[model samples]
Target: MTTELRNTEFHIRARDGAGAEEHGPYELDIDPGRTADGDAAPRYASLRHASLRILRLPPGGSHTFATGDSEWIVLPLNGGCTVAVGGDSDTPFELSGRKDVFSGVTDFAYVPRDAEVRISSAAGGRFALTGARCSRRLPARHGPASGVPVELRGTGNCSRQVNNFGAAGVFACDKLIAVEVLTPGGNWSSYPPHKHDECRPGEESELEEIYYFEIAPAHGSAGLGYQRVTPSGASSRTGRGTDVLAEVRSGDAVLIPDGWHGPSIAAPGHTMYYLNVMAGPGEERAWLICDHPDHGWIRDTWPDQPVDPRLPLYEAPDADLRPSLNETVEAGPRPSLYEAPDADPRRSPNEAVEASPRPPLHDAPDARPEAHPEDPEGDAR
Candidate 1:
């Protein structure tokens, strides 16, 4: 059953359904343009910054599109492809993608705005075009899988693997921030309910987020998971709030305009994966979130508990395997968007936490750094 809430609507739950089509194998497409078509269109138009499209290609298939005013990343969900960008004399980027989301991390390509882009695959596969409207036209580049920082977040059942491939400081982008999360069956990620719907200096940044999910199959049957988004009260700037509670499966996507979202629960026996795409109106490209007061205490307990043994699903690539940025793509030197005063790109999330002085668990919520100590530098979501 495919469902969508329309106009000024804050929460949108898009379930995968037969007959839901969007040019070729684009299972779902959410952009600022979709919201202008009134009730007939998907009610995600209120989203001004972030956009997402899921494309599935058969063996030996290809697709082409214009970037317009947004920068985009061609990320392979499964399989590999060649990304050709218009106006560039450089050779097209060759993404040696993985077998599936459950496999190892995959490489990606970033294309600047106002350019023509073509993606072709000799052997068909699925890809996610994650995008965000922006002003600067950064150079097109390739992101190697080995450079992606993999972090294990939370403890016990909350344990999950975070692949910070397009994370703010990890990759250079004008307004987009994207990452992949993998949760073992029966565990909960995105826990303790959090929100980034307001700009509160160092506390939170008002970013719109999209959650696209894919559940691993159990034997011959499909698997499922649950997503929750509740209102964060009325806001003077955006008016009302947002709300949603849905069972999500493969090809499912949930849009969050303004609300507290959490506990993305995976059913037993079925591992879950979700790609998070985020962007906002803020000039500073950082991800700062405020946890719900009711659940904020959960962070305190993590220090005492042991992380689930199943964590660190996979390790980061060895240093020797990492390729030089100049050899991979033709990109200019750009400062990191989410750099902290003392951030070290070379350190892992866990290593950073160990190196820094531990803050008291009872510290005032607003006093915490822009990002959780356990997350990549400058990222709290």
Candidate 2:
């Protein structure tokens, strides 16, 4: 299901489970510069700063395109690839990517705007081309996997791991900000509902964000997750507010133009992963946000609780101080607060509990205490 509400701000692109049709090599392609005719307002006006495209290549397949006015990062979701920008004399960058998103942090290649680029994967793989329209054209470069900062955020059921690879201060870019997040099965991340929709100087920056999700399969069945976005009494330049509640599966994507989005919930027995791509019109390329007043108090409870034991699923390539991907750490039964009812799996979690009262936060058992580092860029998602 592709929801392009030209009259509104929010949109969703759900993956087709029935294999009814194909969307070619690019599973999802969102270019704000491209617009449909006769629209009351450009469906992607708020997305003018950021763009995302998911490409799946076959064995020995290659793809080429011009960057135009956007700087992009060729990030492999699985397998490996070579990125080349400019003439044939230029040396192409070889990226030793990982087996999958859950495997470990993978290296990436950055290509500046107004250049021709080519990506070839000898063994085939899936790649995420996260971009942001920018005026400055920086030189193409490679980002080593060992350099990505892995941060453990929140505690208890809110525990999650964040891979700040293309973060504003972490990496150099004209306007792009990208990151990867991993949440253990049955836990919640992106909590304390936050928003970066308004330009309030030191408080918040009006950045549009794109969430690309991949749910780790449980047993032989496909897994699912849930995402929620509610209006924050603020409108985009086009005068449209955002609102969304969707059942997100692997290959699905959610576009948030302006709103309070959070609590990306992972279903039981399934690990959840999301790639966050963001960029805005702010003169200072920074990620600053304001937490929703109603749920902001939840962050206070994290200090007393322990982080989920299953986090840091895997460490960076150079780090041997933490557990590897193959090592299984026992995580006891999930807290009763997250237990799902006997309802349709396709329904959003919020919808499943719409008639009931909110569950109280319970301390997770069998977890170890880990320090929650303060993010210099406001709240850590």
Clash numbers, per candidate: 2, 0
**What lDDT does model 1 reach?**
0.74
lDDT of 1 by residue, 1-381 (tens): 112352215333443341345445677777775334432244554577889998778889988999988999999999999999987876398999988988778889989999999999999998999999899887788787766767667766777888888886567788998999999999898887888888887667889898999999998868999888877853324654566777888888878877888879999989999999999998888787777889877666665566676766665444325444443322334444223223436333244244447432211112114332323223223
Weakest ten-residue segment in model 1 by summed lDDT = 359-368
**CA lDDT, every model vs. true structure:** 0.74, 0.74
Q: State each model's C-alpha RMSD to the native.
A: 6.5, 12.1
In lDDT terms, how accurate is model 2? Answer: 0.74
Alpha-carbon TM-score of each model against the true structure: 0.83, 0.79
Encode model 2's per-residue lDDT on 1-381: one tens digit a residue: 223343123444553321326445777776677535733236455566788888889999999989988999999999999999976343388889999999999988888899999999999999999999899876677777766767667777888888877876556677888999999999988897988887887668889899989999989978999888877867545455676787888988878888888889999999999999999888877787888889988766766676676877887666223222211111322111111112223222223223347331221122123211112434447
